[model samples]
Target chain A: MTSPLEQKKIRITGPSVVTANRTWDGAVVYRTAKQGWSTELADSAIVSTSDDARALLAEATADDVGAVGPYIAPVELKDGGKVKPGNLREHIRAKGVTIDLQVPA
Target chain B: MYAYDELDRTLINERVSEFRDQVKRRLSGELTEDEFKILRLQNGVYLQLHAYMFRVAIPYGTLSSKQLRRLAHVARRYDRGYGHFTTRQNIQFNWIKLAELPDALADLAEVGIHAMQTSGNNMRNVTSDQWAGVAPGEIEDPRIWSEIIRQHTTLHPEFSFLPRKFKIAITAAEHDRAAIKIHDIGLRLHKNADGETGFEVLVGGGLGRTPFIAKTIKPFVSGRDILSYIEAILRVYNQYGRRDNIYKARIKILVHELGIEKFAKEVDEEWKAMGDVGLTLDHTAIEEVRSRFSYPAYEKLPHMPDELKQAAHDKLFERWRKNSVSAHKVQGYSIVTLSLKPVGGPPGDASAEQMDAVADLADKYSFGEIRVGHEQNLALPHVAKRDLPVLFKALDRLGLATPNVNLVTDIIACPGLDYCSLANARSIPIAQELTRRFANHDTADLIGRLHINISGCINACGHHHVGHIGILGVEKNGEEFYQITIGGRADENAQLGTLIGPAVPYAEVADVIEDIVEAYLALRDRPEELFVDTVKRLGVEPIRERVYATR
Candidate 1:
């Protein structure tokens, strides 16, 4: 039987940032598509099993649909960031943003 | 002993408050069970079979009198007036309520102790030679490195979510008292060819379902980069370790699957990437930590006390020498191992009063220091040879003078199904029965150096796989039965034991073991042939024949 963690896949998509230090996949400091603004994790993060991602995206569907970003696997956060399995949603929520997610990945 | 500086104290205090909030959140249903489980586990709280079990760290197995007294107080006030010393050199209090855990953490912090990182998939308590500073063969104290590693790994942001639990051990002694070879990371410190102090770093060694003696990744890693080198190894594991299966999550599995050579290559790559800039031990920082663990002042004393010599010539002293005594670094002093494996009792248990008494002895006899061994015994590392009789008398009063150190009766048995939620069967009763059967010390010692370890589950916290005669308690038809394994050991030469034959009814385990010992006596090349060697030379056939021939 697959564990709760194993059965789900997470995909995160957001604006890209290019710097020597911020090039890593799990690096938390990155640029937003909205120009001249940088987003770094200070309070909360987001983790999505495909199911959690799907539910989150469904909730955000009525909002600016295009604002629903791509999905990045939560496990990728181990590269060094405040994002973890337990507090991912809270992290994104704390950043005044909602996550766009997909299911059955 | 690693003295807690302002930072250590501050970190533990902050952890207490953090865990207190977590506990409140859990209790008020603000957190889900899954969320609370990880949170509590990270704080060293476990929901065991009968009740909650809290594992309190004794960093590098060194504890102060004040800390020990606090443990006694916690046991009396919060637990069942007893605590069990664990093989990892930590103390575990059983029967803690989920509500009372926060209070217990608060109590522990009041005396410079906390249970942080004792559980969870993070680096553990960082064990070392219990007699680190005082052991005779030790070139330098291992606790200094252990403390460094401890501080480096505590709530380490990079390592909090490992594939599985990680254990690291260090030994400065040639005899390998800390069992360094069977840990996730083992460090054997030695002076290099250039007269510089360095370490032989071993990686991917562990004991469990798959017991592997660590293979040398670096013949000698310079002492300065120990932290960075370790970080590199963990990075390699974190990126590539198999987390698909819980059983295969340990780095040992990754080492085996990748093969040692390939694993070494990955570690080297990671090491190169994580350079020495932020990770290497600076001389000032190393000195600051090393100063806390500097050698205790030794006043010159006589070469062998007359009283001790007289007692040594007597029967009781001879027995104690065969059992309680260990090699000492000081001429007139000795390292005394206080055996907790008394006949027909729990292997690592001491009552609250007994804990207080051991604390008192540590204060009066051993320069206010106590070392808890991985074998579940306590050590007074600086006992004067002259004080053996008095010490023996005091220990005897506390029922700790069992004279079965490393003998058959001095078994290593886990809390088993009785207290552990993971156990399939009870281990304590089997241990008790074996002790009763081998009640005679002479008989027990005759089967010398017999390390009998029993674990109720495969987690092997009892180190059953390394025992000379290992027994595993398994559940069959909802009843407890024990299966015997032979030739296991956990020292400089560590080997996983092999199963002898079929499982035995719990009631007959002691008799079966006696039969096995009798077989060893009958087929021995000589008395000097230890149990491990004899078993290795002749396999498990003789013991099997003797055990099952009649029944």
Candidate 2:
């Protein structure tokens, strides 16, 4: 039987990357091209297919050197090689805070 | 207001040192994520969606000007220059780095504050009526007993690893400002027939997936024996509270399963077995705590100051005064609740500069004291009536003066899916939308005393179960949906809200609320009857019909 986490994993239709919060600061990070964690989403190792996404997620989970709860989340690769999270939650996560981050001087 | 003694300070310092070492071990890969999670939670550190969140306890909602300044400094230096005040009367820094938490805690310790027991499956912060000492109809100062409970429960050896998280609240006022009936242990201090101060202890009250109004286990526990009795209750819960099911772990479930009578009998037996094992309060210690919370040096002024009388005629000042000011026990003083719910902003988020300004205002207007009300607002407990206009103007300049306290615009919301990992849907945006929709002061004034509480999940961090109008977010098939409940109240007569209809999409929440308010307006006997009272008189049927009419 598949684990609950695996069962919850949706069918990957687009390019995806394994993302999680960094263990030290809980900042949103992605599994990088060099098998390390990167704060920049553009540097993430994007897997093209479901099998590749699963493999990437498995590798990210097994490493456990820098992140917690690594999971495959879909991302959109822009023209300038910029990466954006597909969902609102992840978008907000990438931005750090939901509301305006500015504080009055 | 109770100043930490040598022992208190030492314990906090030791705890911080211990946590620092724990953090070091975790970062160095000596501790696993699961192992570190428990330790971090015990110290009020949460790994949220974006960053680590650190919650600091404001003991019984009391803070000195110096402590407030320290909080502001922490916000400015460590966090994103802002902090969110919670419904539990605690402040949460959402953008904290885990590595810097130890240093942040050290800074907090200098001001006699710590985050211990603010989280974890231990006894959390001991909250009391915000106007405990100063409220007009208070029987006794509940903060004294709250302080006593805080001292006793802070890292108690046996109860540290309880079945689940526990909360204790105390109220000494005729009006239940502390929401006592909805805590794990709600201690209501009142004068008995013999004119002696005693407690009416209620146990098993909680809000989460399961909401319960606490049952009176012991109707009258005397002042000296309150700790021992509480220990007895805790012992009973520790022994019999369910551990297998996380959902059924709170003491409320245990009390529910065993029945209040059986639970009371077990507590009584436990109390008898303990035989006053160092839990009784000594007169000197009690007096020492009382002395720390002495009345501020109030001047001998007449009942109504000329400035206040002059300001009362000004429409804006009168509007602010009508909503913000409450009668104090002292004739010349008033309890001023500064609304944290500004238009189109998160309900209780305050910037570092705003916190500093509030501290300064407290010093100038009040007696250098600040209070965190359970309604997610700050209070200047002893503001002289003469300084009303000046204080109002200063607050207005800071954008803190939203004359909508207890009105529809004053929403209480949790940091839902936006920040919390456990939340399925967002609460802040919903609160923002509601506040924006109800920005009209005339409309809000017409719909008086409506407490709209939104929780992201069933944990009920927003106290949605006790809200006059409660909104709970649930995810259905990966889409965010909201369930609305009405006729709930968190006052002397506490009742959990009844669900109005089927869950509505997020976009329709404000419309549903408006429809319910319209239903109330149509069905009410008079305008003077409150929304909750009108709902009680006419059942949820009228509102439910209107809400689901088109469907």
Candidate 3:
């Protein structure tokens, strides 16, 4: 059985965005309508259909120098065109680690 | 603690240079992600959720003061100001840039540390008992043999690309602190009837989707032929180990399918055919390796010195000493375990400042060497008994003196979904909550020696299968649910835990664990009866009934 990552089958039941990590820095990134990558999820090109999601992911992956592992991730489009991640994983990814890291004084 | 020679130093420097060029090529589109993934992973660079994660090997969990300080510097300079110590007895920097990994590795190389084969499907860092040399009544210091195996297995040509990843653990003490039985290849050094030391070689033990306790294939293999014996086992495995399915790829599966008897026969045949040329560990070769490590100059003193006698009046110091200190082979000394599992904090995490402080403490109280425990803690292996009070106070100031070693609060957890891309749930949060549930140290001491290992997924990175109580996270209906297991243990008689009832929702995990402990406390015949022992006597049904009593 293939894992969810290995399957890579997009089923955009609701609002989604094309997401990846920056190639050099390995930071979470989203594809914008301007055909570029942004670190902010708010700047992502939201798609609701599977076909549109696939197309957006394809376009995002083409920016191999800017992004790596472009895939469609589900999200819940909130008030004022804002997007809240559909799951805990994307929530942490969009922000940072959920727990407070113990940085010494 | 083995000092690096010119050869070891040169290899690491060359590796750093090669990696720099590789990163340059990757950036220039000369190497695709598919090709670069393997190369990066070979150097222990993993693409975690937020950023690239770099894991550095603290080989056999040993580090000198200079090396620890260097790690602290790397934590401050190249990545985040903290690093997570892993159950495999290594340190991982969660926040790292792919562009800067080469430089970080170069800094590590100056102190003879390298991440080579730390992540790939190759020989990982060899693990041993943290109190190897200090623990009393052991056959020998397991690190001596561990270093020998490390040299033999480092970038080994034939075994590098095996069917799946392999892990090896060594323990010389009878207490089995290293959890050797859960490793792919577990070596327990022991004496035969003739009073000659040899290895009790066990193979095919592992955790994950499928868990199995290792079976002893050979009761004894002479010290001289240990490498040849291990090589024989690997050769047989390389030929017969399944690679068609990733889940079934581990040598444990092969040993399970082929049966231990048949597997042992095959290894015996291979060992008979394999010639011991340079592989024999003779006295000269053994002494040569021993000469590399320097021992601490021990001072003669009474077992209970004046300082400790006076300090014992303090209630807090007594609690810390009773729980965190262990007897040493040498008189007037003890092995001190610095708890990384502070309550409500991430297990095994230490800030750069904390690392530097520990380095200073090691140089002060103990020898200038420290050992990382497989249970996600640090050990000061040679602390003078007279200095215990001062060391305790110093560690307390740094918030590293949690009196909960081997207690339920000393939870072992994987980075889980928060950090690991493969996780189904966040283990740290669960561990944090559970540790909070048992926040009182006196209550923890009263409960006594219950291990709770949590894994974010079935990958078993947290060694949940061997925990006295294991919690495995799974995604159910897009929400995290935890499956609880009971009666598991990692010891001389290692066994996998049995699942009890259905999976519980994330909100109910901690309470359910509390209910199980409540049942143990109620059902136990005496105060000394452990949670695992109670489960063994009455079975999980009793505990399960009590846990699901409310539901």
- Best prediction by DockQ: 3
Q: Candidate 2 on B112-231: residue-level lDDT in tens?
A: 889998899999999999888899978888999999888888899877899999999999988898998899999999877898788999998989999999989887998988999999
Worst 10 residues of 1 chain B by lDDT: B26-35
TM-score of chain A of each: 0.28, 0.82, 0.89
**Model 2 local distance difference test score:** 0.88
lDDT by residue for model 3 over B1-551, one digit each (tens)? 78988988988899899999999999888888888988898899998888999999998899998899999999999888999999998999988999999889999999999998888888889999999888999998889899988988987889789888899999999999889998999999999999998999999999999999999999999998999999999999899988899999999999999999999999999998887657888899988888898789999979989999999899999999999999999999999999999989999999999999999999998889999998999999999999999999999999999899999999999999889888988899999999999999878988999999999999999999989999999998788999999999998978889898899999999999998888899999999999999989999998899889778
Residue B169 miss distance in model 3 (angstroms):
0.3
Badly placed stretches (over 4 Å) of model 1 are A1-105
- Reference-based lDDT, residue B24, model 1: 77
For candidate 3, the per-residue lDDT at B237 reads: 89
RMSD (Cα, Å) of model 1: 14.4
CAPRI class assigned to model 2: acceptable
C-alpha lDDT of candidate 1 relative to the true structure: 0.76
DockQ preference between candidates 2 and 3, better one:
3
Candidate 1, residues A1-105: lDDT per residue as tens digits?
011222244443431121111111112232232321123432322433445455443433222212211222232355556443222222332232121111000
Rank by TM-score, descending?
3, 2, 1
What's the count of clashing pairs in each model shown? 9, 0, 0
Off by over 4 Å in 3: A1-4, A103-105
Q: CA shift at B143, candidate 3, in angstroms? A: 0.8
| Predicted complex 1: DockQ | 0.01
